[model samples]
Target: MEGNEMKAFMKRVDYLLVGILLFSLGLNFYHLNNAGTNTYYTAAVKSMMQNSHAFFYASFDPEGFITVDKPPVALWIQTLSAKIFGLSDFSVLLPEALAGVISVFLMYILVKPNFSRTAGLLSSLVLACSPIFVAVVRTNNVDSILILTLLIAAWAVMKAVDQKKLGWLILSVTLIGVGFNIKMLQAYMVVPAIFLFYWMAVKLTWKKRLLHLIAATVVMAGISLSWAVAVDSVPASERPYIGSSQTNSVLELAFGYNGIQRLLGQNKGTKSMGSASTAVQNKDNSSTTNTSNGQTPSNQSAAASGQAQGTTSSSNNQGAAVTDSSSSSNTQAPMGNGAPPNFQGGMGGKMGGGTGGMFGTGTAGPLRLFSSELSGQISWLLPFILFAVIGLFAEFRKTKKFDMRIKFAAFWLTWLIPMMIFFSMAQFFHQYYLSMMGPAIAALVGIGWTMLWNYFTTNDGWKSGLLPCGILTTFLFEALILNQNSQSKFLVVGTVLVGVILFILMVQRMKKETYSPALPMAALLALLILPLYWTGITINKTNNASTPIAGPGSGMGGMGGMGGMGGGARMAANMGFPGGAGNIAPEGAQDTSGNSASGSQTQDGSMTPPTNQDSASIPASAPANAGKTMDNRNQLNTALLSYLEKNYDGEKYFLATDSTQTAAPYILNTDYSVMAMGGFSGSDPALTPTKLEKMAKAGYVKFFLISGRGGMGGNQSESVTQWIKDNCEEVPSSEWQSATSSQIQTSFGRFGGETLYVYKD
Candidate 1:
């Protein structure tokens, strides 16, 4: 690479765009070699890379006993990357990091044609610097990839409008179907926007538009269901059990577990775990009662003990109460469905018990997304959105034909509004899922700023003030969020000072009748400072192993990113908030293990669920000084791996455990198959006594780690657990694990505490 070649490359390079993308690449791949991967999903990647069936099903382990909760498309990308690059933290996370960068670029290209290049850059830059967006991009979770797919679909929609080609429209919706496979129903968040834009912008006849729209929907549905239909059609015996489904059916999963349950905030499906037969769809608008300052009662520390166990099922309820240790009580509604906040199959949500709403999203209302619990993640530029939306349609009367700006604005609004409503009212959702609202926010802010500025310098009207108002209002909002989080006063002061100074400068320039772009550019940079720094702090840890939030102390991993970075997750817990997993059992239900799994008590004295999401596993790379954090948590033990590998009996599975959490470490650490008998949460009813007997007789599993609560499922799962205890021989932990590490893996919660019991014939 001589200077001449470099010079030639530089000349062809779109440096401004490349520079923004490079910064995004930096954020997404900054510590690629060192950062922790989400252990839960990463295990699936490891397993999916093992064989064709595992690959097709996104198996959580090599044995193909069960699939990961989400569809296989995103994991397919990661598995391919891991295969080509050789599995490692960096290799598995590359697709998402790259997707993050490419999505930034897509934002630019998507905006530039309809507006100015600067508008595109502004949109791209906002997205690139977004803390939550960067956080998700840096993880192995499917959200970023899902976002990338949706953005590509957006580009296709643009093509259909620009060219009036029905083929392009079809391609657009088809890509959306691909997105559905990446993230289940989340991909549909943008579908309405797409259809609205196409119908309003395309010049086709009304009948043609109707017919074309119907065809597009058909294509979208077909593509969306392609994998699900194929997987579901296969005999239950031929494929892995669907991870989150109650009935072992993909459609049920799509419409239920990953679908409505997300909105309902309950892991409802079975009558086994509680008295209710379905997920509690009845919304309890009563606030989750907790201690003042919004910390969970009895949770007095956020310091890292550095333990890393995955979310546990609520322990067998015995109706017991103890002093000095009980999860905070919810007065009315209980969001727990006997699983952790990290949704079944380890899809994590808001990890901490900070109350805004049921899941720390603030009480459901129009102001919900604006609440402190939610705003810090995605609302820095929200004030600008209103003015932008109104201004976007301002030029509609200037021409009889529909404007591209108007069309795009309508599409973006459609996308943002539905998502806003969902995030505001929906009970069950992770903060990172808010990334869906980001592109629209960025696009509108960019274009709206452009519109406002054009009017500010050239017109003498009320619209001219919107820019300064938007900037100042955003400044106030950022300050409020900072103040609420108790963030650095320096950052808050910086936001206000920077915003006020920019507003003044823009106002001065407006008076002077000069339209130089410097003020707007400076304003954009001013807005980016805080989210950028927040993104920086989040670069080291996986945030929460499952939830993957950004910002200072945003390391609560309900799905157990806590599983990967035990130290950070502990530090987050030490931040003095806890919520995520717990369950209340039926009265008189006998506890086989003799433990109680209950949450806070309500006014009527009935119990709510627990919300503690600290991890028991930490990356081996974590700072060694985090202390003896691995005791009784789910830390991956090399010695255990060596023992299982060395004691091979030509069995199909190296080990079988209660659920994926117990098996994820072994699957990710080694090539051997590890079976999670009850699937993701040990509640899927995936195995039966007959199946276990056949596997045992066939020598398919030589060992069973009966160390945790069997599951939150029915008689089938419990019966299988009993059969194992009765039929198999329990090996002493001293023979394999370190003497001090015998109880080295708490399954999901304290009620489901770790107790090492290895059973084998």
Candidate 2:
């Protein structure tokens, strides 16, 4: 081939790759008009834009009263974007959207140097269309940014090893450190992968490698802990109380709540995992013991049931347990005919245990990713990738020294194996966290495909035979997923067609005794059809950006009732907190995956079903802080806001609530600060009785809003609720409806369906 021909060939590949990138951008930005799905972060973005203190502290409101349960880095980007773009939902989410596009590009570049351009493009395509990757990127969740930063970090380290450049190594760890600032300890999962890649691929002496790693670790820790240290350095009184901390220490939060809890699955409800069926019995025993406190067993049971039904009850039985007992109980709640009660019109909540351990409940094993709720979202191509990985390792078994491809493959395996185990065993995690596995999965898929392509096109009988077997296995797994989740015949038909095509292609290649490159490509394309279709469904069917998921049915493939396209289903009406897949918010708390407080035990390891949320809009698993659009649940009760503003005109806080949920939307929509009296999870002791008394006396706080069934915030939420109940007059919902009576009311009735009360002098 001549130089000009080679240049033209490269140009076409570049154009095709560029086209794929644009396609990814389009998918990410499709229906991107959400005013903010994750309102917890949305409110923070608003507050940060309005108040310098809020920006610095990452507070949930402009007054710097309390921060979100996360480090400020991810929100900082959104805040800056909102500041420049005028604080719309689109502005806040733009950074993540751009990150999604760039991640696809980076994945391509990452793969291209070691493999063919075709392999690079295919990997990028896989990453781009990955359901959860696309879903999270399109929402306000911090995972997208975290994923991007980690990808950049991986790229940097890869370059570091390739060029033996210390600068690249520093740059790599620094980016990982930045990711730590975005999501704290969750970002460090990839550190081992990075260190190993560098160690294996770099031509450094063993001692020098160890020394270099030590220095990298130091830099990484400094960057990772800098913000936590800074926030902790400030006196608690001067800065917003760190949200989601048991001891009000971010450092403690780093190690205990977010760090070890994730690794060991030492969540609140974990102790009861063996006894999930006996939650009621356990509650009964506890109630009997506490009977001397004037609470009868019947009353305790009633309160527990009421709490389960999202009625006006405060006590959480489980505290910070990770097991979904409420959801589990709801699952086991017998309606006489063996049917569970429909809290909403959605599908009954399916517990993790069933025949084959559907959602990782009954079992925690190596194969957890191959089955269950987590499987569908991120693990679709995982099995094929794993087979490819094994084949690559086996094929290269004779080589005594590691090559670039082998080293790269090892790095990805290092990345995938740990996370797979973590998610498999961890009692608490959301499906979106699986986004971390995207790059590794994509890399393996690319490497595997490239190898198979080479093997199939060549005259290697065993390799050719294995290609067909792997394709068959992947098709069967996908078909099983489709059958389990969708009522659409498209999946069934597609599966059959894929099988037929695979059979024909395999026979043609094997009979001719020669490899046809197009046949393998055709098989690969056929395999992608179902996931691509599912991705399309996710893009078009997803209404609530808060808990974005991919499937034929709305909201994480929960419903077989609303199969196929165009369901016209509204998104979740008003999810309370941090409500995404597997990331269940504690009762009356926002989703606090990383923070200790919100991640703390709810009374029971159960989720309150979002009342009247569109079944289509909620994820299969309701996350804390389920999404509510500005026009939907987020529209502040104008009359209520006006009443507070007018009556408490000069007050520092317009209103106060037990948790951020009751306050965040008001702050975001009204651009007025409302005090989160407890914190994000209503568990933070940010405001004690003394603090409240002082604030009330100072006229800095007033107009307390008692929203819904307030949590017994351990004692903090209960204390504040009691204080407001004793000192404040109940404000009827009718009076609260003075402003939006003619407009659209929230799904529950009006203005978040929260009962409001104003503090009286």
User: TM-scores across all candidates?
Assistant: 0.80, 0.79
Q: Report the poorest 10 consecutive residues by lDDT, candidate 1.
A: 316-325
lDDT of candidate 2 over 1-761, digit per residue (tens): 99999998887678878988999999888867532256677777777877677798787777777667678898999888876766655776799999999999998899988888888988898998888788778777788999999999998998888888788999999999999888888899998899989988999899988988999999999999999999788766567766655445678667755666554442233223223333221221121111101111110001101111121111111122111221112111111001112322234433332211221222456766665455667788876886687678666874666788888888888988888878777643445677889888888888888887666666465666667777777887888777766446785767867776786668676777556677777777677777777777666653335445565433322222221223313322233211222122221222221111111112332112222232232333333333331112332344565566666666777777655655655665464567765454444445545446556766766666554433323334445567666776787656655423322223332112355666556
**lDDT score at residue 125, model 2, on the 0-100 scale:** 89
The ten-residue window of minimal lDDT in model 2 covers: 297-306
lDDT of each: 0.60, 0.58
Residue-level lDDT of model 1, residues 231-327, one tens digit each, is: 8787666677666454567786787656765665442232211232332222221221111111112101110101113333211110100001111
Q: After superposition, how far is residue 173 of candidate 1 from its true place, in Å?
A: 1.1
Which residue ranges in model 2 land beyond 4 Å of their true spot? 1-13, 264-266, 269-363, 399-401, 553-632, 708-711, 731-755
Cα error, residue 599 of model 2, in Å, equals 30
